[model samples]
Target: MLNDMSENQAGYAFAWNTPKSAINPYLDPPDPVQKSALREVIALYAADNRRHQKPGESLRNAVWDRYFFNADRDPVLREIAQDKLTGQARMARERQRFNPEQTVMDDIHAQPAWIARPLLQRIAFLKNLSRPGPCQRYLCATVRPCLDRLTRVRDDQTGPSIRQMAGHPGLEGLLVLSDMNQNQVKRLSALVAAHMAGRLESACSLLPLDNDVQPEAIRRVWEQLAAEVMRLEVIPPAFEQLKRKRHRRRPVSYDRIPGSLARMICTTWWYRRLWQRRCEWREEQLRAVCLVSRKTSPYISREMALYKREQRRKSLEFFRAHELINEHGDRLEMEAVVRASTSHPVRRRNEMMACLKGLELIAEMRGDRAIFYTLTCPSRFHATLSHGQPNPMWAGTTVRQSSEYLVGVFAAFRKAMHKAGLRWYGIRVAEPHHDGTVHWHLLCFMPPGDCSAITALLRRFAIKEDRQELGKVTEPRFKANAIDSRKGTPTGYIAKYISKNIDGRGLGKHISKETGTSLRDSAEHVTSWASLHRIQQFRFFGIPGRQAWRELRLLAGQVNRQHNGRKAGAPVLADRRLDAVLAAADAGCFATYISRQGGVLVPRRQYLVRTAYELSDVQNKYGDRSRRIYGIWSPLTKERICTHSFKWKRVRKTSGGQISPGRGHLFTPWTRGNNCPHGEKINAHHRIRVQRKEEETIKDFKNEHK
Candidate 1:
């Protein structure tokens, strides 16, 4: 407006560079009264322009557009005007965005930034190691006033559950928080970035434990971040100690229900081999990009040429420099890796149990220490460690070889027990001696009168009748033990083997970083682990041991009710994997028709028992809500819903709602209430949980039904 008036009317223009003499570049002193009179004339003159007469448009913009020329003598002044206009337009747009009709997650930014990201994601990220995804709508009503306070989030405070969060646009739904007057978007962004770092720490740590992620500790770290929000120059080191504190558990608890405890060398070898092997290709890719520039003399493959060609198109120098600095060394401590694995201690235990149970069984015969029996295989199906190796004989045997033979022995023993109607307990342990022969050691509590008959049957199965077929069946002794009374109980003699099998207490340990990689590799590459994969080294099956085991477990369960929920018999629809697992856990002990019950044993329904420590497992990942309610996607409801039990959480396939969302659609469980098309609010009955390996399957199912 000034430029137009200055050029056309010569009234609005003032000498910008003129000295501040308060004379308005004129000879007369332009006092406030005089300036006001002059501006009134110029304003009227500028308003006379036809271009400023746009109807229904902003008068200020219309006036400015009429007088403000794109090209003017003062470029700086024009630029200033342009900036003012842009700022006003942005403010208007921001104001327009807060419309109650369209509640966007970003609109909360217009209010304040101290809001917690969706309560669900925040809780999961803080505790469950859930992936950091899009943050849910902010809890503005609950958070706005607390921003300046020193109070902590109250756990008892009710907030939207994960289901509610998923069903609504978070902050937009909070009408009461509309009047909040503050800006914390920058602060909020920093908080979320810190959360992302915390998640990364959880993933990269050597071990991620729930104990290390205490709620109080997390709150303290968050408060620290909040206190220094203004001073944060970059992403503050979030959850740094959480990462530092994470490491594999010492004395890995047996309550974790490990399937095997053997071959520490192979286990560690495999882990390191994978870790180092992963870095190999990454480092090679860097080298490939680097070598591309120096590819004059070397002949490369066609695939290699194309890959290098592509790398050239990218910023190779930048990537190569970073790769060179971060590249892993070519070698690693092979033995150190194995020595640090969960399998190390277990290996000792397995080997000791493999050697001890048979001897202990023999020693348990009525204060006896000398009653022992052995079943030796005469033929060599595989070679042992004693056999010279270029190609070891054990390599030819499969994992099932020993297991199959041992299972046959169980069959014969069970058959003998049935005929004699004996309630005697037995223990059988198997191992391959250095001579490449698999042998079984057995101990059975039997009356002297019945011993010979059962012993004869055992010998028949122990040493196959075809002696010539067994290579050299020399000294195929049927009775190798004489019961000699020695002590009050023989269990101690055998208990040592059990202890060794669990922890390898007496076994010598060897794994060294100084050892050559080839030597370590060779030691781990032997066929022993694979051969024994399918075999159970020790077996116990008898009335006495089973009864006592059940009694001890039941007693333990009774003592810790908090960890072990009541042994309620849950109805399983067989929808999810836990149906069978939990059902077995709820049952007692079983009885076989062949074995007679011992006087000390009670008649109980046989069911598999699991320890409290072993019973902890989760099927639903994101479905577990903040209120301690667990959830799963209900196929019948076509949406995620909360359920108390894992079985109830499964999707119900047979049932379908009559009042669908139209067009063969289904409604979410929460939406089905109040506004239902039916007479009464119909419950969205959940179905057998559709067991899905990937989350996408559940998502796709929901989408298809919706």
Candidate 2:
């Protein structure tokens, strides 16, 4: 029948109409249990395909084709079908042992959505529903309440038996809780709870052999506690280290630990705090163990650093020798062009300073008050104390996690301000703490009357977590200072931070307060930290965006080129507002540009000029169409001006007096004169002719002398 039908019809018939016994006679017919499991699997497969399917595609057909028609050809699909059939067969056998009226099939069908989820997700859901043991019940009654107050996770969400939660992939390898008794589970639960509550000392006290816990059990519990509380993804080096030294009964001391284990412990708050009490660590030791160690930071490795350095070297070499040639025969050397672009560190720093100064000037003219605020993450996010000691309150949070926390707080603060109808403008600089936690320095300008309200809202969000630890003073978490012009300018206040995070220029011999190192020496580490965490270092809000500013600058350059060295007036822009913005950007006056485009309070849609983008002819590396900014569009004038009129390509330069062995041709070296309207082919031909004439003259001279 299949041979008589077309391929599509055969596929459809085999997928929908054919029975399992028909396909393979030895295979038994699917019972209700197996059929239900198959349906669930097919339903999930269809849902997943629906997410990625095109508009007119049928998910039903796609699922059938994938599971039935293609199963024989595709190993993955065949394995999945076999696994579902085998698992359902086994489950059907187990269902026979239970009541015939209420089988596992009924339960599976009752929550098909839950059954369709991944194994780990299902485990997490079941773990949450599982009843708590005695120790977990105690923690839920005491420790969980405090944690609930501090974290977004509610008490109900954190519901116990933590032994069941051990099903997490990260914890599965560290502990074998399946064989443990009630006493062991109670002890492990209590220890994890104590560590979570910043009570590592109390947890350690419970680890003594006198508590009726086996030495091996204590070791496993400690490892599990460290892994879970610190949120470590991999088995800690301490586990293997302790295994190698199984002869010892007590837990290892900090000084006697391996560097990898030491780094892990020092990077976590409670563990670091416990170690500090046991041993006095010097600043150098702390730096060596925490800052310099790469064991914990996987995003940046020695290989990656070497790769980046090599790439930088090649980029510099390429930029130094090559010239970018446009379709109009216009050429610009790549090095000079790149240095002027925003990606350059020095250029970016200068632009940021100019933007800040511009905002300050505008604020002064409008009678707005300048307020400098330092927003920090809660104590739980910090890894170390200010004096280079481990913070007892640190919860083993990573730099990326802390950065995200600050971003969330700032977002909330912005939302609150928006609701309150307050307008502000300024720059925010994110820099890492000494221990690699990120904090933000925001220089904001707001009306004098609204300053207090804004500060209050920010303080409320910044200290929302671990508020009790903040005590009576919240300055350590959220600090606000009115920029007093009598002492120094607002630009001066933030300049050091900006330079310290960037190139650290003009900061002669100044030391960083956080790291206690020379600002110049520590700047590289700060930059690496930011890069490793993928954090945005600087952001400007309540101003015309940087893209529009850059485009305007390009337009101004175009206008300058149009009338360069001529005795004619400069070309006029399409609109008066456009002309003003172009002039301001040309003059490097960010304040004027901001005002002409739209003041700090105006929305993006209301801006006089905006960036215009077009879909590219080529797809990106991911095989998706990407948009490229090509020109500027003026909303007021209803005109679009294409600033990028010519496409440019980088060409390698040939050195002077160089001859290729294959062709015996003398190459013309690239020079400013040769880059003019004179074509490169003409120059090369002329140079070849001159060289040939010289060679003939030399031959004649040699013959006459002979």
Candidate 3:
């Protein structure tokens, strides 16, 4: 409008000379204050157009747009402006009018679109959060408070129980906590809080045991009262100890009179009095000897020596007449010596019985002069010397070979004594190796009449075996062969052999440094490159060194040539190659079975075989009857071939659609007593894929339907 008015009035306005800066256009248009402010702004702009307008005319455009409604406007621009203006007005009203207090209650009474949409959604979310039901929800609300107060409920207090008759008022759905006091309510609150915090069971476990109540009632209380919450009750360790303690009868009373006179005469001081009397008798014998020596002097001493000699000779003749002494003058001692031995630790019951039994045996058989000894175990020696010396023995086998051989030798001697029907003795096997041969130094106990028979048996077994071995034994000497050569020097030759087999396999390449390079520096440099290559281009299967790789490739070429022998075609899976396949199958089958049983299955390492000969080699390597290498991809060469065969097929095809599953021959039971005796279970055996009866019936049903 301003532009159009100005164009018509341009000539007249020039005559009137209305200087645009002096006459303000807005002065007559609106409120006086707005008009005056608008004129002031216009006057500032008119004073210097250059000063008001920015170098890019940005400020001038902005000023005109804000102040003027007159527009030579683009339709798009005008429409955009109108929309912005309406939006601003609406927003302003909304911002000024909103109140939460009014909306919250108003929404309940008459839900607007937004409110109505979320009610069902909110219920669903809350219900999911609530879980199980509202009773759990309500119980959840009170549990914490109830638990806090539970501690204060007297230990004798009857804990809560739900008492509802079947088909009665509380039957279907109701929570009635019987015998719940205010304190229990507080405890319940604590319990609920714990439950909310995911410690409900733990909190219940923290409850004091109702020791004051009946044991049965206390047991029932946890099951019943704790039904609404999780609870753990700890049994006292003292109770556990008591349960494990051994039960034994009390010692028989010596103070009380017995029915039998023999038992009645038993008294605590009897042994003490008897020991004193024995000591007195020994003293008297010494006094009498001293008195006799003083009176007879040198004459009595000479006579006594003669008499002792004569008595010894007579005793020897008596033993000889009875065949107690052998022709070699070795005689069987009436009482045998005791020596250290080893045995398994006695169980508690055995130990008690042995103690009583040993005392009885000692009293009946052992004389006063005989010394009795119990064995000390090697285990005890091991414990004592653990920190000090290492055993010189192998240490078990070294000691055993020597000790056991001696024990066997002496055992033969003892057996001879026993065979003679003489139960009157002890024989001990002695320690130490004898003349480089393990032989027992026997101390035998035998009756005077049985000595000759025992000696003869001992001589026959030992001497006969000894003579045969001695006849063959020769002086020790080293035999030299064609061993000292470039190929067989001790260390160098060992290195050659070691490098070829498993002994050298894991040692990797024995790459040496070049003439001018230090081994370490060369290794470091080579290692860096190898590591980079390993990360970048390396694949599983080949040995580490370049030479190993060449050998592998050569081996692979050889396999390929052999495979080509049968004409080029798809390679057959070999035993070694099928390992990964079988492993995958086993793993998958196990995983599926476990999954069905509500467990998880972790997949095994590889899923396929890249080389057939590899499987064949593995089957051959195991050497188990269950595993036969029938075509496997080789790990080294990556060629497939059948290196072996199985007597039975692993998997078979049936007339039915179902493929019979393979049994893993790889896993056989490993235990004694026929636990897993043969390859029957380990090796796969074919069974009918489907029951014939069922299959026939199904076929008949299908035909009938048709």
Candidate 4:
């Protein structure tokens, strides 16, 4: 019968199988009360089937047909009219209806009149009869096509609703309604069959929301989804996890003292007693983190001594190799002329000439006054040389190798000047002129006579000797000499070479265009004082004593010879300032002179800033020697090693023309001149006048004393 039953209708059948049975010895059925209830339900279904069946035919339209349609031969339902007589034979064959042996049945059988009276009373109590149980109420509610239509829409929200329906009796309600459909009916039939087979409870346990129902009936599905949405909305603050952090504390007070001083005093008892220690625990923690090194003072000192020894050895080696140091340990002087070219080959000849003239004027004012001057070649000479078109073999080197040719020429000039008692500052080679001739502007510092001699010498070697002519040179004229007067005589030459050249014009034109500064003022700003100070510190060494100067000349010669020997195919240049003559010439451009004792005297605004070498205070008695001077009070106690008699010894008077202990007196405050010794100020003296009476009293006291 279940195989023919629809799923929708199965709900009604299941509804009848409710109400737990009372314990009765005679109740053989597993669910006696439900079985009785099902019998009544089947009777109603059989009546309905009969009404729907066609008239007169077989007992198939009867209650038995709906109750047990699969019963092939039931004698009770087989009777036809007199043939299906409801007599003793059929009564004996059919099962007793509703347990006739029960007391209620016997009572009903015995009191037919009482039953009719009860029925009469129930007919007047319609309200009580209309009251519905929970199951009946759910079934009676109006079913809507909206539910079926909603299930057809594919929505993710629908699945939860379906699961929710299965969770409660709601799934049953949905199944009852949907059972009318063929697919629903098949599913319902399977569920019913499983229940009959005793596996329904276990199968339904695994279903979502604990139900065996259709998917479209849940109410809490949307609510659960909303909760899930809420759960994802706000992310928690994770700054504490993501941030980079470090642990640190206040610096130790020991760090307050500088390393140099602290190292000397750190372990002293007095220092430890005076120092304040705060937060010992934190200090210990920091100490642990720092991992203090082992105190191996002896080892450290040994290592330091070793390092010092190594350093001394390297220094000695360098000095020996380069000859920049001597037995006296003074650096050798390097007098060099630095001629930095300002001319751009692409520029006009007039512009180059102007820049050259301006630079010359600067050198002259700075006391670098060029002994001889000439401007014969045009600036376009390089282009002319290129056009001259020598054969490839003849033109062995490119124009870039101009330094090589110039170095040879400069070397020859240096030798000539040396022979003539003129000093060459350096060679400043310029580009070839429009006439295809390479010309040079020489920097030389010599006497007027020597300068004249050099002009004659130039005529001897120059390509067009007739073209080389000398001219008279004088300092440039200025409206105000205030700035000029402040400069040393040599400072004028310093100012001349340092001037900038622009647009084929000299410093005069540039100074004119500049607002707020005069030509003289501009000229004063350009001083050779700094250069002089630097050169004073410049010392050369490694020259044997007898020919020290000659050795330097040789070095200059070596530099020049290397320049000349360079392969024409290789692009090599010579340093113009390497020539001894050029270096000597440039040295004269210095405004301040350097002494072995005094360091540097650089011109500062109105005065000079002098920094001298601080000598030690250690004194040693020597044959006719003055005492030691100023510096550290601690004496240098090294044992005397050299047996040779000292060439330089300390002396006393300023006029002695000797270095002495009172050399500090020259820098002392007592010197009442522009030169303040030792950077100290002189105090003024005040005179006190004695009145006539006071003088007489003083004289009387003096006479009494006599």
Candidate 5:
């Protein structure tokens, strides 16, 4: 009957020849128990087959015959044998489920010869399997064959050693690799490969490992070494497994390594490189999430924005409640004092614009030329194309790396200009590309004769790498234009950029050419990009440093206070030049300030005055002493003038209803400028003591907390 059935009508069948009692040996009267347990299974199976069978065929008779008959034309007594087989298969599958801890042991046991090997050889095999990249792949591919070979070769026998067979001529420089710890080996291997491949230009570039070498360089070199090692093959399975496990673990900060051993490891080149890569990866992951959230929600959630606003309002209220009192009994609200400083965004922007305008005016008066230049990184540094597709040529370069590259290029240009005896002063504005790579826009003022030389030097350094990508026109890499008086002022050209990066004010309906998004919509992302990368957006070079300028202003304030009510002709400083600089700073005239400070061309030490700093009495939270600006010192007069004459202290506010100091009340003098040396530790101790006191005050605190 089965042979007569069509292929589709004859469903899959299981054969059994054993007695029915054998299917369930523990249960007596197995027929009833087995039938009850398998009734659902048998009915489902019969129904499935019946759906596919001919209409006239009896599904019940077919299932009965199929379960009872054997392949040999013999009557099978066991009716539940198929069910037992199904249950056993499922149990075997459950047993084979993946467990990271057991997988290695199971693999080792599969090769019986490995169990009897010497301890050293067994250890080597396990280490090789645990490592990532080529070593692990090689071990996995030839595990069985290699183990058999090892078992056949005795200690007394002479044969090719595993080390000799595995060694590559290119990696001979790393001969002592096996003896070193994992981090050392990885660092040495990467260094050797980078040197051999000529990826690292000079040995000096790798020194002062923490500071000199950029994280991007480390990331690139390690990636190159990894690629070369695992060329033409998929990533090692062990590495993938370990990577998954690491991702599942809680996030670890790379800012500070806790243990001495870990810090020692971080000192190595490879580890530092890995640290940078990990940081970049984390930032990119976060940025991606934020971008997605912004896309899905057109505007920021009103509740979260309002909550943040409320937090700011409360903080301002708290600050307003306190006053920073100087020794003279003068008091100022902390909130008002801080907000009046240049740290405020609107104030900073206004100051920068004023400075730029002053510089341009000075340049015009001196018959100097104003030139605007735009500098961009190479194409490979960009992670995405203009159309928003991932660039295939990008090697995982990040915005921070691109910004660093631009900075280095500018530094080189500066050095070249200094060597050639060129004089120029300007401001540099770093802004992010639509895809987050950084580019620079510079508005420089130079003598008419030196403008060409400056432009040539900038272009040379900017296009030094991947010069071909610019084709016949090099403007894509570096562009220069003479500031035509008819078009607009140099300050006007850069003012919009400053506004866009800062607060996006007055940029109504303006669209970004790079992303085709509204400038107002993308301004927040641009600001966040600069902040996340810690890139300085606006920097003015070839002028007096801002620190000295601030110190001069402080000195001017002190002078004004001293002569407030006195009949003094003029407030005298240490020298005449110092008085002029003080006046310029007081009037907010940057051009006069720059001229009085020995012009933009003069070196820093030759300036009229400099900032004087003194070491703090107490160490900071990091247990390191830091310098604080105390006064201004005139280089010409060789005289020091103290500006920070009065010490201020922070204290809690007292209301009108609060008790005032009485005759018997004891007053504790403020020491160390009222700054706690170990603020964090003291705060933690106070919290613990308050909690204990609260527990003592309340009897049922523990039960209530639970």
Candidate 6:
């Protein structure tokens, strides 16, 4: 009679044999008490089939269609159904329900009464873990290309920029790629940050631990990442990462105290690296979330227009100081220019012409000093250049090849400036036209020299190297005149070029007004730019960059010795500044400011907010040589090797430049009158005083002197 049984609702039908429990003991399933509601539902459906009639058949997935989805349905009508094959059959059925991209582990919290978590964890973990790590295709094919379009690094610190975060063990989240429709690129970037902050618990909660194997696998990969972070502990603080094996060891600590000094250097290195990594991760986060891009008409800067109006000689003086030029018209060497570019060699000279003003801003900010000069007073020079207009011949060229070619142009331009005696601090950012050809915007610091002469030099050299190497400058290239930066102008000047080549201003803005191809579509139209081009988009030169790491290292050591142990083999406290910065963190987000009042019981506001880098000690080094160190981060060695040197060791005073050793001279980025080295209460540029030094060295020195 069951042979005539009709099909169940979902078009599924099964013939059931006479009750299997009554005939075959080997076919018996577990007792009803052990069966879950889900299982019971299956058992009842099978019994329904058996009573209906066909022999040697059982109820199929139609039961789930009937009961698992409809909570009102009850399945325990009779106890005659016992199918041992139910488990495998149910799994197979579940697998068929979702698309291949989804996993059964996704519904862990959805059905607590149906399947206990332990059972779910066991079964789901095994199945997903056995699956290969998330598809690498989305990482390479979709996300990377998009990132290459979006991320552009300005050369400031040695930390990894958003562009370089890829391939870091901290960024393994890219492995668990979701479909394109899911907007997984943003999630992948966040996951990388999560790993960097060591937020394992947060990661565990946000991602599916049992089903999506890739996230779990990504966490495991970073054990090696932690090892790399730990390995940097050997490098001295302040110095860039070791880019290559140095031919001979350059002592990071030149101290004579030996073991005590070595311990200090090692400890400082560890804290510094930790801070560097943290800062870099923070910068990456900033770029990922806050970087603003716009597609308004070409930037209109009155400062740039003013720069164009200057006489040729006047414009030349902006980059090369008038005092340094020779009577014979020979330009000062690169060293003089580099020195002059670094805050004009003395506090007396304040006019920083061109985009070079940003260099000072970079220095003061990097040294953890407060930014007193508003973006309003910026005196900078901006210029734009194009390689060729709508050239189809270079359409297929990759970003790497184009970057190499640009390097040649850069070298030629640098040589021309060196020959012509121009030392400018500026940034060069390349933007691709809709056609995929490249154009460059340079924010430079050109003195009040002959604007015509400066323009001539740029025009002459822009194509010089390309002509030299390729044996022909067949393509036409155009160089725009340099413009000076001013109020509201310098702020928008180079920043526009350096920002992501995006379309809409940002999320909350008037996106409807945005015209032209979108930033994303533009990104997709071009070949992978960042993946192939390793060069920084913006560059700085001859600017007061960093306090010599050597100086900072000594300070860190001194602080450690005093707080912990001054004797050899004795334990020392971690860096006080780093401790403050770390302690200032609320949750995983690092503090943008810290109190400076020192043990003062004032409100947090009274403590005075200071920047991340500024949270460190800077006082007492008031007049010291805050030389700029240039370098690159090596992924292979995980080191940032310092490349600049003291070629003019004799020309520049070397040792006495050490900031007077004791108190009343501590200079932080926030320290006022930082430019005026004179201890006399003098120039308005001089900030009055810094918070008293945390060290007792001043009193000791005074006592010893007396």
Across residues 163-248, which tens digit of lDDT does each residue of candidate 6 receive? 24436665543222211112344444344434444533433355555774562344333333333333333232222322223664
Go through the candidates in order and give the C-alpha RMSD of each one to the true structure. Answer: 31.4, 28.8, 46.5, 46.5, 23.4, 25.6
Tell how far residue 540 is off in model 3, in angstroms.
Answer: 66
Error of 2 at 631 (Å): 1.2
> Highest lDDT: which candidate?
2
**Candidate 5: TM-score?**
0.53
The weakest ten consecutive residues by lDDT in model 6 span: 373-382
Clashing pairs in 2: none
Order candidates by TM-score, high to low: 5, 2, 1, 6, 4, 3
| Candidate 5: tens digits of C-alpha lDDT, residues 603-642 | 8889888987776655543433456765677767665665
Task: Estimate the TM-score of every prediction.
Answer: 0.28, 0.52, 0.13, 0.19, 0.53, 0.26
- Cα lDDT for residue 670, candidate 4: 16
lDDT of 6 at 20: 38
TM-score (C-alpha) between model 6 and the true structure: 0.26
Cα error of candidate 5 at position 669, Å: 14
Cα-based lDDT for every prediction: 0.35, 0.59, 0.30, 0.29, 0.57, 0.33
What's the TM for model 2?
0.52
Error of 1 at 299 (Å): 46
In candidate 3, how many Å is residue 200 off? 35
> Lowest-scoring 10 consecutive residues by lDDT in candidate 3?
335-344
Whole-model alpha-carbon lDDT for candidate 2: 0.59
* Better by TM-score, candidate 4 or 1: 1
What's the CA error at residue 260 for candidate 2, in Å? 38
Residue-pair clash count for candidate 6: 46
Better model by TM-score: candidate 3 vs candidate 6 = 6
Number of the top candidate by TM-score? 5
